[model samples]
Target: MTATTTAANPDAPATAPRYEISVGGMTCAACAARVERRLNKLDGVSASVNYATERAQVSCGPDVDPRLLVEQVQRAGYQARRVDDVAGADGDDDSEQARRVTDLRRRLAVAAVLAVPLCDLSLALSLFPELRFPGWQWVCLVLAAPVVGWCALPFHRVALAGARHGRSSMDTLVSGGVLASSAWSLWVMVAGGTPAPGLGQGLSVVNGGGHALYLEVAAGVTTFVLAGRYFEARAKRSAGAAMRALLTLGAKDVEVVRADGTRRVPVTELLVGDVFLARPGEKIATDAVVVEGRSALDVSTLTGEPVPREVGVGDQAVGGAVNVGGWLRLRATRVGADTQLARMARLVRDAQQGKAAAQRLADRVAAVFVPAVLALAALTAAGWLLAGQPAGLALTATVAVLVVACPCALGLATPTAVLVGTGRGASLGVFIKGPAALEATRAVDTVVLDKTGTLTEGRMRLVDVRPASGQASAELLAMAGAVEAASEHPIAAAITAEAGAVPAVTEFEALPGLGARGLVDGRAVVVGREPLLAELGMAVPDELRAGRGELERAGATVVLVGWDGHARGLLAVADTVRTTSAAAVAALRGLGLHPMLVTGDNAGTAAAVAAEVGIDDVVAETLPADKVDVVRRLQRDGHRVAVVGDGVNDAAALAAADLGMAIGAGTDAAIEAADIVLAREDLLVVPDAVELARRTHRTIRGNLWWAFGYNVAALPLAMTGLLSPLVAGAAMSLSSVFVVSHSLRLRAFRPNR
Candidate 1:
């Protein structure tokens, strides 16, 4: 016997451990439950199957043989691989299998067409007596059989296979009940029994015992189960569409330039070191570096920023970005699965595979639920038989228990809510990584914000210019602009913009980190930071320092300009605050979370931005590596933290935090690392995501309670022979309807904030 273990429950002992197993070869819902049942049969195994992606995760005891478990799955005609190293590769086989499963939609459509008429026939016989034709009824039943069987053969096949192995599932319960009902009805018809009066019959046959054929009941149950399955496939397809769309973003081909000549080739065929020529208005086909020429690339597809970024030789260009102007020759640096887009797509795929904590609990309850119901039904029949009840009454009570105690409602609860919530979040420009991330967002207590690009507009602009030594402001600006024009730094743009007009300079020289120098109007001019001016033997006055302090307090980067090697004036430039930052910060605080600011900018600028956004705690002048350290420190202090950032530098911190949120308008590195990606740069979506996750969590819990309550309360009533088969069928259908309708409420969610 193989050892198995259940997932650690929240109320379980603290010493209990949790485990995850990777499942494979699941092609549909039936396959999901099939693997789930086989693994669950082990003493302590508890598992959930995510059909959208073919993976089953199970948790169990420490003594279980991981190898034996894998062999059990393989014996059941599917692969089972342990997730020993969570490489996050989105393994090649899963993607291919996911694509194959998408075709199940065709199967669902066929099932739906067969179900409609079967339901109509069933309803007509029950509601109107005049419509019954004694001879024609058997003909209708025969006709409906093929349609129902053909449409429902998938479930029958899986259920029969499970039964052969002494295992049972939701399919086994449903398939067994419907088959028994259909066979009994056929036997009565063939044996020449008295006909059941149609609806509105004058005779009351209730008190007197009479045999009646119920072909419609058998056909209807099969049709209804098929209908449910069709919709389930459709829902899985809809949710998995995002991963497919992400895969479609890359271009199919690129214009490759080889020694022989330039020719177009498939992107997959392009190898590293292959040079590609991208002309104005052409899309970059793969991740590459500019080897020649210059161009302004519109990376809006990846970053969501509108401004076209200028790139020259040696700059890295990402795939899917459009080259807006100027021709460029790029050497392919990364291709195929190695591209950034591919990596991001892989991340999204992996996230979908890992079930949330709530979902895992639901699976645990469902695992033993069907078998327990089956045992109760058997006991009910034996009890009534021993009490000398008629065989008809005893058998009817047993079948009713089997039919009504189904766990369909329990199975649909969490996945349905998750589907609706994730769809709603995506529409609102919130890209949730997976169900676990969606659930975790509700518990976030600290929101760590990156000062640059997140709280502020990432683009720097000139705010003020002050002249020194009694010189005219414009004169200082003109000299500064002439020298600064030779530099490519962001601060240089502000200086040149303020300098309205200046003569063309000669003898231009750049001082790397310090600044630039050039001869303007036959006079040498220098523009840079204060330290650079002092290094050039220029005097630093107290007035200049005072102006620098004021600007720095306002989150501005101060630059100094000089003429003839003498200090001239100071210029202040800073990235402005976003209009939505304050409202977003306030909303987070309303949710009982303290917002903190973390940035690579200096202390003065970080403090200014934090104050503006109502963030109380600030960590400034922090390097990329230090950001992750800070998040760990906060976590060590027992904070459930979520980090929000928008730069490549923030990737480490984003991956380190409890929940990582990447502002959509940033580098691919940040988006790939973070668990949640805000599709719109608006900060309000952060709080909106949290609220949505919380609502989803509530719906799941409510649905779980409803599902559990129904099975617990109604199963006994059914076993006691108080419920008839007709009543049991109606109750079972209603439970499913209630679960679905409850899950649908998440679609209308609108955050109060």
Candidate 2:
């Protein structure tokens, strides 16, 4: 997460060092924002805090030790430590999330066990007077004690932490409500008076007036809040499970080749420049270029393409991809953190740890919400006291208002949705960078797709073949395929693939800068470009001239097939338009987004590909550097453009677009610059990601509405004495639960193919 830039001052030896730290006990977006605010207040420091991942990305000057960043976060009211400093025992189950889950379950079990019985007894006492007996209050208090005191430890501790930092959070509300109810019960037991076995049996007042104890309120609040926290933790873990699974895809070990001998070692032990051999079924150890052997790699693990990609000498292979066919000897170009797989994992992690604009606003509201609620509670108490209500009733109303006004819901609204949305998208092979990328998708009106790799297969394929007026089609392909079998070019491969089982030529001669000459069954066959056809003294036949011209106009590379020194027929080769690309373009149109083809190919090629894929606007003849200017021009024209591409040449354009979606198989530069990554080669993910963003934002808006609406409606009722303290406690705890539960619904999101 750290990137060092040279200091602007020429004389300065160094600049600020950036550090990322993980802070424990951040229950809401407000807590993360508060930590970020405190860290940024320090001299020469700036920070971005993400609650979904519970990590802070911080930058500070060299003069300030990185350790101080942790201290600052601690000052902002949470437990803190540097990410690199905290090393748990190495095991899959030893992750921070696993530990949190274990801890939450334990606390929730204890609270629920005690709370249930206590609530039952309190409710039983209210409804069935015969169940009341001597020492019943004592028994209820005994049961509620541990539930509020021990089982509720986390909330109390966090609330105190917020107090020290002069900020209040969800914990503050929960702790205040629990402590007030518990203290009121204890105070009633000590001072209010003792009741006989049959006392209050026939009393119509269930309120208990000033003498009522709320042992159930204290216990129930603890149990419900802890239960909510447990489920919230589990949902968060589920949301990030895909990313964790991705981290495990890289090879664990590889055979490192040496001058003396090859030695098997852990991938961590291997370094750049080391050569390694990958077996037929083994995963590629790192990002490397093949030095020997040919194989079809199942790179779908990285690119989400269903087809196996052929890789041979000098072709680069990504780590985590399995070599499905033949063995490959590769020279390690990138190892450890430098590998593509590692970079992608890092991107997902870093993207998860970013703050969205909506979350920032929610945090600001929460920072002020708790204090305002407390003030409102105090005003309500004074107003009631002035109106001649008893002190106990006033205190009850105050507690109700304090408990009902939930900042937790507001704080949980955005981060939880982001967590589930990004996680679900990752599962779908749509790597949404973060909330900002999601936000960009919702606004973008035009999508620009690159031709070579985006809308097309990026590989040559034989599209058509024509034989002279009366000649057999099979005979023409037989001779052409025989000549092409001697070549290693992509065009040759496409022709050979479509040639079927053709008879081998007797003698094949290679033609440089042209086609080849061969002999099939004692007949002279010339296969090459038009120049080679002319060199063979082959005259263009009148009947096939129009057909050849049509193929050439459609962006195909046409080769002249000649035999016996005369033109025979024409064969066309072009980059295959992906079978799914037309549907993807149509889907974008249905979404009311204009799809344009932006390619550096010749106008004929670009227009032909565009027509095939239903793209009306073709921006052809674009220079690599000028791609950015194209995106900028679209922006100036009031189009919110999202440009999709797959190479280093597209990096600038990706960065310049309103939203940049890079292909997963693209160069590192493009992926790094992109706001979103199409991890799957399917063009459909473009519209899928956009539709997913719209859905996620819609969910966020809905959650915020419920959160704000609940508080707005409930707070007044609580103040006006329409809602009781017991009801208020239940409402407060459930509000947070509702927000988190709503966020979990996104985990069920399944995008259309």
Candidate 3:
């Protein structure tokens, strides 16, 4: 879970490095906040600590050593280590969590095995004085000793560690509750004279003096709290399973195409610019551009798109894609951690390791929660004594308050949900950047979708070509294709592709957004939009003019083909709408977002695509700057807009909107600007992204409500002397388990078909 970034400067004082470190010994949100506070106290340091993942993201200058960062965390009463350093030293140390779980399981099993019989025997003897054997209290003491000493030792150790640092946590409460009950029970056993038959007579007294033995409560509370910790640890591990699975999807080894021959090498040893061979049914070693052969590659694991994408020479292939059709030679563009798969894993981890606004508030409340609970317990006990309540009743109320108000649920709520929700989104080809992106989805009421590359395929194709009266179709097409071949626009690609083979051109010049001009076979050929041709002193013939109007009206882009100051033909190009686009638009509307088409295309083309996709609002002929205006206007009109696009031109608008979702296949600029990334080509992920964020946000809110509400409702009952310590311990442990289990529900979240 280490994300490392460094900026070096020769003239500057020090370099800045940002990375993640695993934190140990955090039992609640207060501990996390404590670690965060310590790390941030350093000069030029910024930090965010997440208790759910038990990791801290820290950014500081080189002058602030990582060792110092770890020291500060240690001083805060926790263990800390740089995650990258651990990974480098141990090479995938996955056994830490397993070891922790195993230890917890062993402790819980011992506690349960002993505490059950101890509680049963004590209760049976107390309820029926006749059932008490001669040595019944001695047997209860022996059974309770191991549980209170060995099974609950972890809580005692953590509480002691916190005490040494002048801090406390949920473990403090648990340890206090257990030790108090056991101490009271031992005092009764030792101070009270040896009794033969009536030993269990007054053990069940509620309002009497504090002579009642609480061996059952001591053993029972220890067992229940240990059980909760064990289960909570396992569930938290499961919440991050999807990310772990994703991080392991890369190829382990690759066949390097060296000068001598092909040689298999570990993927870690593979370098950028090395040519590699991918055979049928083999995973592409890393992000590479195809150098030879053609194949159909399956990228479902990366992008969640089921269809196999056909790739040929010059096409880029991502790491982890399976080459399912034929052999291909690829040259690595990015290797190791620089590959797409690595970046995705890092992004998911960073998102999970971040604390949301709501979680920060919870952390603030929990920072003082343990101490406040300790104070409240004291107040309850004193008030009960002052109100003339019996010492036994006051003791019961004090223990209950300490046991019930743990704040574990408050710590687990947000991070667990975020972990599971983001993991679920990743599986469906939607990458939520962080907590901010999830929050952005809650109030989004308008969706501004770009026409080209978003709703439509964005690949232009030649649909019609009408030659002038004296020109042959072949001659006209060749001239246009030769000049267009020198250009790289989509329309040029379409004309060149349809022309098949054409004469070489010289003195080629491309007119940005208008078209291109070149000397094809030394005849001065020009191919461009009508406005460009008219500006070049070319006149459109009557027949070709009529053809251009007919094609333009039908939503096809018409570019005039002319040479030697005379128009020769009219070529029409159009982009096909993606088959899934209409359904995606409908899905967005179903989620209560108004869909609007914003494009740089002409009005007719924009309107045609909108009508086909069931969108009524259209903003056409807008430049990149104008697209931002469109989003801003909608926002000013009381709408929170989410912009979707996949081009460098759309970057500004994507950043200007309330939320931005970029297609994964788009330019780096667009992806950087967007809050979420849709990896699949299918537009349906747009709605899936929005719906998933909304669902995740709802889940977070629901978890927080339950956690806060449980404390609010449960605390009063305990303080008022209504709940016993055993029941309070059970409820406290169950609260953390419930929050974790509720978060695990997001693992089963399914995308719409």
Candidate 4:
């Protein structure tokens, strides 16, 4: 048995462990792109930054220092620290995140409260003409002051930080818009006198000099932008909630047993090889093997299967499983980073760091977008001022340009869709590795499915039974089943299941990996494969071999049952094909995706299973490593391929495929390598994921076009002075709202077929 070991990765760094950094102060997708670019520029370092998660996963070489990562992030005007250290070092964890949300809510409330009265007063004075008061400008000024300066503090702070780092973001555009609009409004209030106001003037007050007072514009923009951020923060938090829940599932404390006495210790203090007592309804402290008792363990938290796994002495039990049966004593075999739960968390982190092709383009464009918009706004103002336009008119156009061109939509176009899509996938039992997983799935023209544990239940069972003509099948099975019952091998258990009750057998003997030899009811009986039959001196009749040739060709593990040294019957054992495998294959084909079987099993076995599952393409008798080569060959043929498997041996192939989908019930290594993990072990989810990906990919593109189209049409209108700052501000807010709303459509997704 090639027992899977996961702690020591063949691809691990020699001296430095990978660090997942909790990045602070990223305001947009462009900010994440910049941080990733800066970190990657360092020698012997690679980084993937996700703005939605506010996390950076970094890999460093022995030649480089890990501290350099923190320093580089700091220089880029963001904070970074190891994920495990971030929450405790600053005395902030979930509370810090909650506090940020609270801050946005409070600021939004303040801006809303102050802006409402200011707008109401301005409207009343403009329409009635008799509501004028002494220094009403001062009252308007006082109300607009904190709404712009204090309520919009987050924008100004991030904008200034970006400026310090020689960059700009959506925040810069927003801050500039508010400042330009507010500054000009103050100028008119102090230098120009307000004549009587009238109706149908919108939010602007036109005085004797034709100068405009935009107190409402200043307050409204701040309120709208603040509302967008508050909702955006809430959505981002929702996308990451699953990972946080997974991290918290570990048992906080464990009961340790020793020669001195039984005592409880924190789970972190438990060591490898320690003996621990797990009573009924308690979670296993760490990965261990039951040594003294039997119980059924519920492994659903990790595998997503509700079935409880029965364990006896020497059966390995994984961490995070709840003991559902009687008390059991287990010896810890793996702990801390070695546990399966930690590995899944690490894989989730790594997957979140990757950027999809569309996302990369979006981020790169956003990096250049902010600066270009600033220049355009300046040029819009300069062109007006140079053309003999009044300063008030020029500034109005400039502020309008800035407000209209804010890339809130651009920054949100990809990540919002990705966040929503991935969250929906998790609920449907499909965990996507990252945005790229969906992109890859959209292009999957061929699906390479592993035989064992993927299309079949990776366990041997009785598949075919034949006896000599006129011989009683029950009588033949009775003698063979009795002799095999004394053995505990997979093939024996399968045969015994189909075999009816039989009298007791004596003189039982076992042959490892071959067959069995014994006496059943005082009659000599034997059961084994072809080689074993020959070894047992049993003469296989030519008629029997010829008649059974088709069964062997169809992938059954043919075994000869003999008595008195002559073949009497044949029994075939095989890994049973899943009931839904055929339907999944048909669905994939209907979707225009070619389904192929790739397996390490013998050609006969592979072909038989393929035929049963409605698959025509078959690659058989390949070694584990050769599986990767097969996937690469398919890719070289210009095929976008997805490999589905559920074992350690399939890990390499799964990773090498364009999209690697692991059955959630698979080994940890396989799950870690897969780009998509199916929590329910149902092959049908493969097609569901494919459909979901295609849908999400379409949604992202449509959103990008909407965002790009809105800015393209709005910027020119604002620059030409046809659009007011108030109108531009409303359009900008709506653009972001539209992107988020479109992305949310994915949340309602379900398996269509």
The candidate that achieves the highest TM-score relative to the unseen native structure: 3
State the lDDT of candidate 2 residue by residue for 539-611, as single tens digits.
9787677876787687876777899878889888898888889999998988889999987655678788888
Candidate 1 lDDT trough over 10 residues, lowest sum = 199-208
lDDT tens readout by residue for model 3, 50-169: 888888877777677788888899888898887874224222434667787899999889989998888777667656768877777788889989999999999999999999999988
lDDT at residue 323 of model 1 (Cα atoms): 90
* Counted clashes in each candidate structure: 3, 0, 0, 0
lDDT per residue for candidate 4 within 157-265, as digits (tens), equals 9999888889888888889888877777776766766632211254321221236566667787788778777876766565555556666667889999989999999
Q: Rank the candidates by TM-score, best first.
A: 3, 2, 4, 1
Window of ten residues with lowest summed lDDT in model 4: 1-10
Quote each prediction's TM-score: 0.68, 0.80, 0.88, 0.79
Q: For each candidate, C-alpha RMSD in Å?
A: 9.2, 8.9, 4.7, 7.6
Question: By the TM-score metric, which is better: model 1 or model 3?
Answer: 3
Deviation from native of the Cα of residue 245 in model 2, angstroms: 1.7
What RMSD value applies to candidate 2?
Answer: 8.9
| Tens-digit lDDT track of model 1 for 369-488 | 778878887898798789887544565566677767757776677666666666566556566777767777767899999876788866677888888768898787888888777765
